[model samples]
Target: MGRPPGAGAEGTWESALAAHLAFRGAVLDVAGSTRRLSGELSRLGESHWGIAGKAAGLFVPHVEYGQSQLRWIDDELAAATRLAHAAAEVEDPDMQLALLRLAGPRLEAAMMGSMLLAVWFDFLNLTDATLSRHLYSVETLYVKMERWQKMLEPSMSALASLEPEQVESAAEDMPALVGHLTREFASLLDTIHKGAKVLETALVLKESMEALTMLSALRFSLPAMRPALPATLGVGLMVGPNGVMMGTRIVVSAEWVEMMRQLVRAGVLSLPAVSAAVRIQAGHVMMAQGHGDLPRGVRDALGDAPEVRAMRVTGKSGAGMAEPPRHHVMPNEFREWFEKRGFTGKMRIDWFCVTLQQPHHQAIHGGGNWKLGRKWRGEWNQMIMKALRDAEVGAGRMLTQNEILKIVAGYMKLYDIPMNFVRCRGK
Candidate 1:
């Protein structure tokens, strides 16, 4: 179809109202669905490994990557809502028309002028989606399929050694169950790929407000047209541009449920970094002793392993080099604030600390060369605090350690911090 007059110029009150509702609905839907999946993952991971344990730490991330994306969507929604309210409801249809005719141009201008395209761009979020996978890590199955298959090899071997009864106690068929999960992971990736096709198409349409122009045409034309005309084409074009949400939890969580159950049955129940290193050297015989915690010393030699989380360094080494300072990931100044909201005595402000590369640390705290007092809430901390506050309000409860870490991950990615620099939970 040919382009409409005033394309990208200004949407009608109808289109603006539709865009406001549709855009906000779509953003919340994607973010909300992602949040739901994050919990599903948290449950599966922490159920076996403890919330503060290694399963949660493998990614040091996971759903945490979405924290900022969720908050960013929210900020855009808030702005859109305020702008939409300018075209608020009234008792009379005639009065509503009069308001639109009089103020609609300015209101639409305000909405578009406010860089509302950012909301659409974020919705597309091709780059943001990739980070979600890497930090969010469900895509560990899909993207790191080879790595996952390799990791599962031990669990598979461990399961194979068991008697039929031992396997039956947890899994119906050992190899078959593992095969099912691998297939499901592939299927899940296929589903995402299908959704990506939709996203890619929308991204093309989004250039120069072409999608908005289509929405404007639909606002006037759809109701009067035949019912079977695919009315969803226009307004919905903008809603779920990324196609990354909805029922995703079902697939991702299902994969986790089976994988964890299989691992437990196989006696391959060691953590990825710490305990795995200790017990794997102790070998499979340690699995026979019971799944209780190992002694701290058998694990001490294991800390040097690369998967061991990076620690916050302090002061100087025996060599007298000035170590990069360890700073609290959640600023220490707000300890009381976080404590009140479940940062807790046990979760420990120290556990949340990161020792950034000195240059990055100095950059974060104002600058390396400039005379500096550092950014408010450490600058990074301020936005993180705001995002977490918004999350608590959205989630309707105090955030979990896992949840807080996810938010921090999201913000760190925003600052372009390297993933290796992220100081994980549980030291």
Candidate 2:
């Protein structure tokens, strides 16, 4: 019943850091662009002119830059808030504006807290993505290191057992091998040490940033303002092969692509339009028109069907309804395809697209419809298993639902898919 070893301290530190980051990111996001947290200062401090000019060689990508910006803003906000308190105490108008100005957006109040929140959450997303990739990369690297260790262990053992002449002969042609292994070992040590340093620096920055987050207490003490979670939806379309487009609905906390993948695995959603878009993108066929309606029509058709009607709709809409059109719920068809290929259920795979019928004029005043471009669905599990193996996660090992979902989400993040689309097997 005593606390687990080191759990209390670790938890407290993490909690503190999370709180600081959350509040800081909120303030910065709310204060868009005006008094912006520029990379200029950090770049200047580090003397990295390249980041300011070409914007290349950034340790993190644009998404990570957004996160770093949030961290900086959090630090800035804490500083400004402290100044604001001081100015208020001394009745210094300039100082007060300086503090409050840091809180405001460039030209619009809309740019304020809400935008910062958006960016902060975006940074969270980007961090999640990087963490996933890093985890996979680290895992792969460990495997490779193990192999290298095995090779080195045996070679060293053999060298120790051999006479001096034998040892010299074995190592004669591979003179560089000794040096290479030594360098590699040193490099690995450096990587571990530097990684720890980066983590420590991040923690220190969190502490500095936390000073600004305390301003929330200042606001909470005031009756006029209160903390609230801002709600806004940003959606993106992910098109897959054929005329299949998945309409991905995303929220700050939602993994849009992964959500779609779940729906696809459950057979509750289809993204033919997005699929068509990807096919056009991949140049599988000449660009064709009139495929946009397929996803929408499929949603409508499937909705009216008894089978679909009986299915539980996990998504919610403005009407407080649990289900809406599949397109609105899941937008990225490629994600759907990806998940389906990786699913492990007993569902038979259909590697065909979900196409819609378009209205066209026929002879004799009869109206007819034509099939549009296709969206391919199939035994996606087999395909995805290979990809997981290639990424060195070990395909032989079975994944639980959550692990599978995580991997699916990671894959989408790796590929920079705007949304994660998934569906379930048909009943």
Best by TM-score: 1
Clashes of each: 3, 56
lDDT of each: 0.36, 0.30
Q: TM-score for candidate 2, please give it.
A: 0.17
Clashing pairs in 1: 62-135, 62-136, 64-406
Which lDDT tens digits does candidate 2 get at residues 162-186?
A: 2222232333312223334333433
Q: What TM-score should be assigned to candidate 1?
A: 0.26
Model 2 alpha-carbon drift over 4 Å, by segment: 1-63, 92-427
* lDDT tens digits, residue span 326-372, model 1: 66777878888778756553244543455566667666665343246
The local distance difference test score of model 1 is: 0.36
